[model samples]
Target: MSVPLFDAATPRAPLREGLRSAIDRVLESERFVLGPEVASFERELAAYCGASQAVGVANGTDAITITLRAMGAGPGDEVIVPSFTFYASVEAIVHTGATPVFCDIDADTYCITPETVRAALTPRTKAVIAVHLFGNVAPVGEIQALGVPVLEDAAQAMGSRSAAGRPGSLGVAATFSFYPSKNLACFGDGGAIVTNDDAIAEEARILRFHGSRDKIDYEQVGYNSRLDELQAAILRVQLPHLDQWSDGRMQAARNYEEAGLAELASLPKPVAGASPAWHLYVVSHPDVKRLEGALAAAQVGYKPYYRTPVHRQAPMLEWGAGVDLPATEHAARTHLAIPMSPGLTRAQADEVVAAARAAS
Candidate 1:
């Protein structure tokens, strides 16, 4: 049996008709950019995430840059971020002219903890990006207690939650990606910045456009990165079903244990009290080569993530020349995310586990 990672098309099968109707509605309106579709998505997304407001943007990376600028981060400021996450997290900080301070992550959770954040803080530290990596929510409330504003990097955690609350509500502000792979994905590129702070929300809205609330005047320089109507309309159609899908993913993750994968490899340990969306069902083994060979021979779909930590990337060499990220390096070497999605079936999951058994 062949198991494939991330069956994006399968999940959309159930929503095909609704998606078509949504597209038709957008076509009838004939308003593409920053129209009613985008406006409604912003409002609905904010409410779903337990936030005061949300501003739609072109993509997840733009969402980060706009939110950072709204929080007053710029040159001469430092923003602490975990090196274990996606490159977009660091790129946005650099785009804002803020120096990116690399932070290490906890080995178990693969997320920056309050201890790690404290170690990276300086007098010039203006903000911290708490990445809710792989659908596991970061400890934003604890990190926020450190004084600097904490931004929730929720690109992979749209349906995730912690005891404190949802991702967008936990941090000063949060950013989400609606890429086809995400939990709350649109058909194509789309993103949003959500916050409880009305001041930040107002600034983000202006920044997403051409730096002006009204088209007549320009305030500060900004980007032309607004989310389009078609994508937003499709996302709106999917929003109501997200919770059920996320629950399904979480249940699928548990099936790995039923297949006895834990006996063969180390499964991810989510943070205490976290109800993760399980965007990727990652596992680690001491011998990576063996695991790789077994999965390939069995035709089990899998992908190694962050083999090179963002801080160690060529463009970031100068920034990370002397940084010591022990835990981040370990995760980079060991982690491999396997097939995971609401559409995943028991037979596919069994194939992956059988491969792991052979590897062990």
Candidate 2:
């Protein structure tokens, strides 16, 4: 009767003792900023994602900004991104002194496609950020085939995979978020940049700590952003459980489909050979308002997000000029996310299913 969109407490219950132990370890170490825990988490994260290296940063936005700057994106350099994604994607491009060229999403997957990237291409296109929105892995392999560097905002897709590989290794560089609500969550805000390219990873490492490998020299202008030791330790505890969590979410998504929500709405569809972690379980219904009403009446949590596409937002409006995004517009008008979490129970899921059916 009272299902929340994110059940943070439930997911961490089993790991409570481990989390406490991690915090105790960090407290005992007394090396709070960028210490051994961060190093170990970075190494373990890279290994998990099948990448050569991973650099921890303060948060997901900074991870993207640092990776873009490391990849040589600067003023006048344009990065292609889908407007249907979260605003932080574009904001990161802006922070790196690069222009964000907003594009459309594939109506089904709600992700940018190789075709969309092709449509947004120009001589100044420095890179393309393929966002794996709602845990559906973007078509990174196909996008890379276009020969432009691809940066993945894999914030919602830490455990998701495609035929080529995992999210972190699919693009030229990728970013992951460990916000408490994320699948691979931490105690607080944290993020990482992962890549097979050692050079980019090295740059990211420097960028994460004020442009200096050692404390002595200030090599380049960089923000003071580092994932502190406590958060890193907490993330380490959760990282080992991420694969199992992702599997649970995938199964929950299947349950929704089997319960007949698919008959009433357009469910998220993964690309060929991709396995989405079902981060948000967003759906698009023709009468989305009705669905919203049903969920509300049933005391079930539902969210209508990105109703205003990033291009329409005040700060990024100029980039919207003369840009066409009918698909993005359609998605913005119709889509909403139902309750989904690794800890979501079948009874809670059934409550959601009943509400969705009520809408129909």
Candidate 3:
């Protein structure tokens, strides 16, 4: 059988019963739009994250955009973002009519460092997006001390925690995605913005629902970005087991590390002082293409999280300062993810490590 790169975990059969019941209740009540399910999920999520409030959105991108808009980050403002991240991070800044300043990441953790962010800051810089890439949390406390609004892109980092707090807990707002591949994925697309600021939460809620605090009154121009009730129901069921699944993935990572395959090639390490959720087990070799081919021949699946960093991506090339970013450039060429998921067993991890060792 072909070894797939990942197989996302789902709620246990018993846990899914509640999800089904919740869906059935929503169906019976015919409250498909921002209803009791969404509200309750938001509250639960907020409490779990140690936030005062949470607002459900259509997806993570909208969560970032709405939060940015509410923060008054607009044209002429620059948002510092790590170049080595998913496009959505930069896309949200651009969507807000703000300029995204690309910054390099740390060699070890593959996360944007506070020093890099400091260097990228300018007179127009208003916000910084700390992306918790590959389930590793960024050093947000130091970044927050820069006196700029911080946006936590926690799409791949659900259930990840730091001593200070969760990924977004230190930021002005944290955005999360329920994409199928994420650690806390839903049945379909969904997202949420978590924050302690009541005003920011209220504004995101309004902006997500067409800028209306009241049903009939339009407060400000906005977009439709509400998370569906069904999706919230799915998330609620999944959230309870999120920590368990994350630990399973972490166990898989430890198994891979103990297998001693990392000695064969340079591997990405989790960020210091942060507990990663192990969204993907990424590593790098000098000749990534050759390694990838070997894995293919061995039927061991792999993927490149960001084959092209956002600043280098064709669509967002304008974000670059034409500076030489050795780290980001090197990462784009060598980064490769091995099979890693809550569903991945030790045997599966061993097989992947064996293939990688042979390739190395």
Candidate 4:
């Protein structure tokens, strides 16, 4: 039997009953875009994340760009971000006409700490984007204490919490992606911006829809990035089950721990007060190439979580030309994402563990 990284179909089967009904209801209403479904979903999402408000957007990248624009971050400003994270985090900062100051990540957490952000800070620094990488939350509280407004790139950390609080509630504003692979996902592309600041929330709402509260009135320049009714409806059906799914992923992590995979490779370390969403169970080894080859032979699905850090990417060369990031470079070469999802069965889990042991 071939074990895949994630089987969206198996987990989504149970949601089909409610999801189909919701889709039908939306079709009958004929309110396809920025309609009742999107409004309700926003409210539910905000409440779930312990935020005062949430604004739905077209995708995660839009969520970040819209938040930065809403916060008045633009040209002549710098936004600090981790070089080890996904390119979208830095890409959004660049889109806002702000310079992205790449910072090194903590070797253990694979997350940017307050020290890193502080090192990268300058008078031109306007904000910081703290990414909750691989389901583990960043030390957002300490970073926020630095007096810079932090925007959480929580695309991979929907159900996660740390010592401070939930991802969305930790920062000044938080962004989420409902990409199909995320913990809380829609069928297609979707995203949201959550915040307690009324002004920020209001601005995000307008910015997502061409900077207009009313359809005919244009208040400011904004992008066309509204979450459609169809995707919103589907997200509502899956929202209720998010915690349960996260729990399953945590159990799978425990299974990996019990299998003593740490002896063979480096496993994720537990944060003292964190309850990670377990978006992906990553393991690192010095000999990652050999392990990958063995897994491929056993028909086990595996892939490098991030083989290239953002700083080393061709387009980012101009920004990071002189930067030296030993930890980020090391992580990029060693980390590999094994099969992980709520839908993975015990038999599949055991198969992965056995294959990993054999490979080691």
In order, the Cα lDDT scores of the candidates are: 0.90, 0.90, 0.85, 0.88
lDDT of 2: 0.90
List TM-score per model, in order. 0.98, 0.98, 0.96, 0.97
Q: State the displacement of the C-alpha of residue 55, model 2, in Å, after optimal TM-score superposition.
A: 0.3
Q: Which pairs clash in model 4?
A: none
lDDT of 3 by residue, 102-214 (tens): 88899778898888898899999988999998999998888889888888999989998888888657788899999888888888899999999999998998999789987
Clash count in backbone of candidate 1 = 0
Q: Which lDDT tens digits does candidate 4 get at residues 1-360? A: 388876667777888899999999999999999999999999999999999999999999999999999889999999999888888998898888988899888777788888889989899989999998889898888888988989999999998888777888989899999999899989899999999889999999999989899979999899999999999999999999988898888887887777677778898765557788788888888899988987888899888867888878888887888888788888899998888887676777777878887767
For model 1, residues 142-204, the per-residue Cα lDDT tens digits are: 888988789999999989889989989998999999998899898789899999999999999
- Which whole-number lDDT from 0 to 100 does residue 22 have in model 1? 94
RMSD of each: 1.0, 1.1, 1.5, 1.3
Clashing pairs in 2: none
Model 3: number of backbone collisions: 0
